[model samples]
Target: MFTSILVPVDGSEHARKALSVACQLARQEGSTLHLLHIPEELSHETTLVWGIGAIAIEASREERENAGKQVISRAAEAAREQGVTEVETVIGQGDPARTILSEAKRRGVDAIVMGSRGLSDLQGFVVGSVSHKVSHTAECTVITVR
Candidate 1:
C-alpha cells in the first residue's frame, strides 16, 4: 500500500476522477495526499516575443492562476470529504509534466496520480504521453487516469 501519494489536479473532469481515486487510496492506507496544481508560467519577454497582444497576455495569466486555484481547492475539499485530513496543497509554476515529477521527487512521495490530458492542446501528439514521461522519469510509481 502506498503511504504518500501525490495527486496533480488541473480542474479537468479526468483529473477530478483521479483525485477521487487518490483520496480513496489515501484513506484506505491512512496515507497523506499531496494535491498539486502547476500554474502556467508567463514571462513578459515570452509574451512580447510571441507577439501576443497585451490584453490577451493578461487574460492568459489570470485564467491560468484562477483555474489552478480552483483545481487545488476542489481537490482539497474532496479529500476532506473523503475523511483525508492529512492533505497538502501545492502550487507550482512551470511545465506541467516536469513540475509534477519534480514535486513528487521533492516530497519523496510513494506514488503520483495525474490526468492523461492536461492543459495542453498538443499533449496527445507529443513524443511521449505526460504520464508516460513522468512514470519513466520519476523514481516512484505513477498512475495516469483517463
Candidate 2:
C-alpha cells in the first residue's frame, strides 16, 4: 500500500487514465495523492483535458503555464471526485523526466503514477519517453498507464 503517491498530470487521456488508476490505489490504501504538472513547450499541437482545447507548439511560456494551471487544478478536483481525501497540487518547470523525479523525492512518495505517453509522442519515440526515463530511474514504484 502506498502511503503517498505522486501522479504527473499532463492533461492527456492517458494521464487521466493514470489518475484513475492512482485514485483507485489511493482509495484502497488511504494514500495522499500529489498531482504535479510541468509546463513544457511541445513539438506539436496537443489536446488538453476537459476540452480546454489544443495548445499550439508555438504557445508562449505564459500560455503553457496557464494550461498547466488548469491541468493541475482539474486533476486535483478529479482526485477528490474519485474519493481521495488528501490531494496536493504542484507546478514545476524543467525537463519532464528529471522534474518528475525531483518532485517524487521532495514529496517522499511511495510511488509515481503516470501515462505511458504524453503530448510529445513522436519526440518520445525518437528519444526515450518521459515515462521510460522515470520508470528506469525512480527510487520507488512507478506505474505507467497506457
Candidate 3:
C-alpha cells in the first residue's frame, strides 16, 4: 500500500495508461494521486492523448508550460473520474527524470507509476527513457506502463 503515488504525464497514450493504472492502485488503497507534467522541448509536432492538440517543436517555453498544465489537469481529471478522490496536479520544469524523482521525494510518495516512454521516443531510444532513469534512481517503488 502506497500512501501517495506520483504519475508523470506527458499527454502520451502510454502515460495515460499509466495514470489509469495508478488510479486503480489509488482506489484500492485510498491513496493520493499526484499528476506531474514536466515541460520538454519537443523536436517535432506530436499529437497528445487526452484529446490535447499537437505540440509544435517551434513552440515557445511558455507554450510548452501551458501544454504541460493541460497535461496534468487532464490526467487529474481522468484519475478523479476513475474514483480517485485525492488528486493533485503539478507543472514542473527541468530534466524529466530528475524532476520526477525530486517531486516524489518532495511529496514523500511511496511509488511512481509512469509511461515507459514519453513524447521523446526517438531521443529515449538513443539516450535512455525518463522512466528508465527514474526507476533506476528513485528510492520508491516504480511501475512503468508500456
Candidate 4:
C-alpha cells in the first residue's frame, strides 16, 4: 500500500538492516525508496567556542559527510538492484527524529521504515528513542525494524 518509503540511516548496523528491509519492501510493492542521512550539526562559532582545532574539526565534518554519502549510495544501489526505479537520497542536520519526520512530510511518504535499538519502556520514555518520537510525530505509518 506504500507508494514512497522513507528510511533513516545513521551508519549503524541496525540502520543498515532498516535499509535492507525498506529496499525489499519497495521492490515488492513497486514503491520509491527514500534514504536519508542526517549529519550532526555543528557551527563555526560553536566549534570555536569549544576550542576544537580547526583542521581536526573540518576533517571530522568531512568524514561524516563522506560516510553519509556512502550510506546513501549503498541504499541506492540496493534499490536499483532490486528493480526499484525511483530512489531518492537526502541529507540534513538536526535532531534525528525531527529531521526524519520533516523529510517524510516534505516527501509525502506513505510509510517510514527505520531501525530501533530495543530500549526498555522506562529508558525510552525517559531518554527517548528516535523511532518512538518519529512514530508519534510522523503523519504517515511508521515501521520499526528492530
Candidate 5:
C-alpha cells in the first residue's frame, strides 16, 4: 500500500538485503524507491578508539562517501531491474538516524525499509542502532530487514 518507500544504504550486507526487499515491495506496489546514503562523520573518539590516525580517518571518510555513491548507484540499478521504474538516490551528511528520519519526512515517503544493522555494530551496541532509533522516531511506517 505504500506509494513511496525509502531505503537507506551503507554498503553493508544487511543494507544490501534491505535494498533487495524494498525493491521487490516497490515493484509490487508500483511505488517509487528512494535510496539514501548517509556518510557518517568520523569522530575524534572513533579515531582514538580505533587507533586510526587523523589523516587516515580523513582519507577514509572521503573513500566511504565515494563508496556510498557506488552503493546508491547499484541499489538504483537493482530497483530498476526489479521493475520499480521510479527510483531516486541521495547522499546525506550527518548522523545516520537523523538524516534518515529527516529525509523520510522531507520526501513524504510512505514507509522506510532499512537494515537491522549497519557497518558499525560495536558503536550501535554502545549508542543504539540507527534502525532502532528510526523505528522509534519516524513518523511513517518502518520495516527493518534482517
Candidate 6:
C-alpha cells in the first residue's frame, strides 16, 4: 500500500484528473499527498510567437514562482476537498521529469500519480514526456492518468 503519493500538476485538466485519483487513493490508504509544480521559462521569441493572443504574461521569475505557488495551492485544496487532509506542496525549478523524480526520491514517496500530458505535449513528443521519463526512471510506482 502507498503511504506517500506524489502528484505533479501544471494547471492542466489531465493534471486535475490525476490529482483527483491521487486524492482518492490517498484517502483510502491514509497516505500523504505531495503536490509539485515546476515553473517553466519561455523565451521571448517563443512567447511572442505563441503568446500573441494569449493572456498577459507575468515577465518575472518571482511572478512565475508565485504563479507556481498558486497552482500548487489550488491542487492541494482540491486534494483536501477530496477528503485527503495530509498534503504537501513543492515548487521546483528545472526539467519537470528530473525535478519530479528528485522530489519523489527526496520525499521517499511510495508512488507517483501524474498526468499523461502536460502544457508542452508537442515539445514532449519531440523530446520526451515527463511522465514517460519518470515512469521509466522512478524507483516507486507511477500511475499516469489521462
C-alpha lDDT (0 to 100) for residue 136 of candidate 4 = 83
Give the range of the ten consecutive residues with the poorest summed lDDT in model 3: 66-75
lDDT of each: 0.75, 0.94, 0.92, 0.73, 0.82, 0.83
Top candidate, metric lDDT: 2
Residue-level lDDT tens digits of model 6 in 34-132: 999997764321221111222134457886676667778878887888899899998888999999999999999999999998767777888899899
Q: List ranges where model 1 is wrong by over 4 Å.
A: 41-58
Top-down TM-score ranking: 3, 2, 6, 5, 1, 4
Model 2 regions more than 4 Å off = none
Give the Å error, residue 118, model 1. Answer: 2.2
Candidate 4 error regions (>4 Å): 41-59, 118-126
Model 2 — TM-score against the truth? 0.97
C-alpha lDDT of candidate 4 relative to the true structure: 0.73
CA RMSD of all predictions:
6.7, 0.8, 0.7, 7.5, 5.4, 4.4
- Model 3, 1-146: lDDT tens digits are 89899999999999999999999999999999988988999888999998889999899998988888888888888888899999988888899999999999999999999989899999998889898899999999999998
Assess every candidate by TM-score.
0.81, 0.97, 0.98, 0.77, 0.86, 0.88
Write one digit per residue (lDDT tens) for candidate 5, span 1-146.
Answer: 99999999876778888988998888888898999988665432222111222223455777667666767787787778878899999999989999999999999999999999876777888899999999999999999999
> What is the alpha-carbon lDDT for the whole of candidate 2?
0.94
Tell me the lDDT of model 4 at 86.
86
Candidate 1 per-residue C-alpha lDDT over 1-146 given as tens digits, one digit per residue, 9 for 90 to 100? 89999998765567777888888889899999999987654332121111222223355677667656766787798889989989999998787779988899899999998877654435445556667778779999888888
Better of 3 and 5 by TM-score: 3
Clashing pairs in 1: none
Return whichever of 3 and 4 wins on TM-score: 3
Candidate 5 yields a Cα-based lDDT of 0.82
